[model samples]
Target: MIFRQICSEKGGSLAYVLGDPVTREAVLIDVAENHLTAAEDFLRSRGLQLRLLLVTHWNASHEQAARALRERWGARLAAHESVHAPCVDMRTRDEDVLYFGEESLRIFHTPALTPCASIYAWNDRLFTGHTILVRGLHPKLHGQARVRLLARLCALLERFPEETLLYPGVENQGRRLSSIEEFRRRSQHGAGGDSADLLQRYRHLLPNKRAAKQREKARAEKNLHRYGPGQDVPASL
Candidate 1:
């Protein structure tokens, strides 16, 4: 099996293509809007036939090119059932397998990051899209949703083998891949973070339902004072 990476300049979003050398059949994972041409070129250059386009989730930034690529390459599009919009040819479930020659992909539902977020393990490699960042800094105010997501990530740490190689959903600051054991240590005792620390980063943002609404109300009033209506508000403020 061969693996290739395609990256987008805007967000460092990565798309992966895996090819079976014996059969020259390939599958694409989590495409970015700007990298479709590169994916096509990689397959074409290897004389491989594109068979599947799998999405890790249904975010527009991640999957806007699904229809165009499906039509162009006659590829079957797959995603989680929760992402029930157009362009998905197959709705995937955890442990479902997609075969490309001798290689088979096993999908695992990982709802920590988003409703439809998932992890795909194939040919001794794990392709996790955006559910865990190997290096990119998570935002400071992602709310309880992010807190819950971190808990899920901890669960995954206890579930998978230590040797499993991780290709995170998004590119790391510079690293290409990481091992599960490495991730475990990094998330537990790293200089600037840990699972509990990660959760704490969002604690203030994740108030109870009533407090959250109240916070939003206060924020709106604060914005009204600062922007004076019909004006743009700064994201951080």
Candidate 2:
């Protein structure tokens, strides 16, 4: 397999390009609108035909790019069933296998950060979109709900080999990549302690519901301003 990771200039959103060297077929994951040209250029340079654009979650940025990419490359667009993107040609479910040439990615519905968030695993790498970050996990839920969510996430992660590489949707604090083992070591969610005690210890680290809403509102406003009312911003940004 051939692979490259592209970082968007605006929001440091990460996009992945993976190609099957034997078949010369490729796929893109978490493609950002701003990096569409670059992605196209990379495919052209490699002499690989794009087969699909797989989104990890629904967002303004990805929604806009997905349509343009599909039109340009005639590649199929796929996402979680809960995603309401018009460009999506395929609605994937947990354990669904997406194929491109000889390469295959297994989809895992790992929601909590967003209803449609998912993880794609190929070989030893996991492409986690907003579901898991190098700095911390998404803090959209709190209290007992948060604890249960964390436990669920931990369960899924623990199923993977410790050496598996994690490619997050966005870069945090200049770090864009981590290993499952490393994340498990640094995150409280990885601890064997009870969910209640773990939740208590990490409760302060997560934002309150009100603050999270305010942040979401602010982000929405910012997107509206940047892309104009109905326009789409780059997904990763």
Candidate 3:
């Protein structure tokens, strides 16, 4: 098995390239548009054929690259069932196993950050996108949903081995990796009932759907203004 983490220098978004060395088959996860060339180059250098493009969540920045990558490599695009992207060739469910050559990844639906959020487990490593960062859990979930999701997340975390390594979507605190045991210990300190109540109390602070849309629109406009027309905008923006 071959694994590499490709991180964006400009934005904090992270992408992964995992390949089965024996079979020469690879899978890319949470790919950003700016990293496409690098990813393709790496695959070519390794003599690996891209077989799958897996997304953990829907982000405008990287989502646009899915179609282009798929068309270029004939790779199948996959994501959680809740993700309504046209580029997705397969809608994955919790516990779904995705196979590429001799490598296989088990899907774990962790909706603490977003409803479409998912984590893929391969061997002792987990590709967790925006769900579990080095700092802690993402703080953008709905009120009651936060509690419910955290409970589910705790349960899921417990299921994994203590030594399992976690590769988060974004690197925080200058660290890109953590272990299930560490996260479990941290979670125990804050995932109690009080934290749930605190989250509920601050529910009003979370952005609503309209605000999120406006923010996205603002970002797109900003990108267009900054990069001008016909330029490939970095997905991190």
TM-score of 1: 0.74
Ten-residue stretch with the least lDDT total in model 3: 191-200
Tell me how many residue pairs clash in candidate 1.
3
State the lDDT of candidate 1 residue by residue for 1-237, as single tens digits. 788988877677888999989998889998867888898889889998888888886778556788877888888888888888777889988778889877788898877546888889885678887766675224442546656665556655556789888887666566667777777676556432444565667655433557767999999999988777445655566
**Ten residues in sequence with the least summed lDDT for candidate 1:** 135-144
Full-model lDDT for every candidate: 0.75, 0.82, 0.81
lDDT score at residue 209, model 2, on the 0-100 scale: 61
Estimate TM-scores for all models.
Answer: 0.74, 0.78, 0.78
lDDT, candidate 2, at 122: 93
Q: lDDT tens digits, residues 1-237, model 3?
A: 898898878766789999998899999999988778888889998999999999888888667778888889999999899988787899999999999999899999987667888999998899888887775677665457665666667567767789999898887767888888777676556642226455456556443557778999999999988777455655565
Better of 1 and 2 by lDDT: 2
Model 2, runs deviating above 4 Å: 189-196, 200-237
- Identify the superior model by lDDT, candidate 2 or candidate 3: 2
What lDDT would candidate 3 get against the real structure? 0.81
lDDT of 1: 0.75
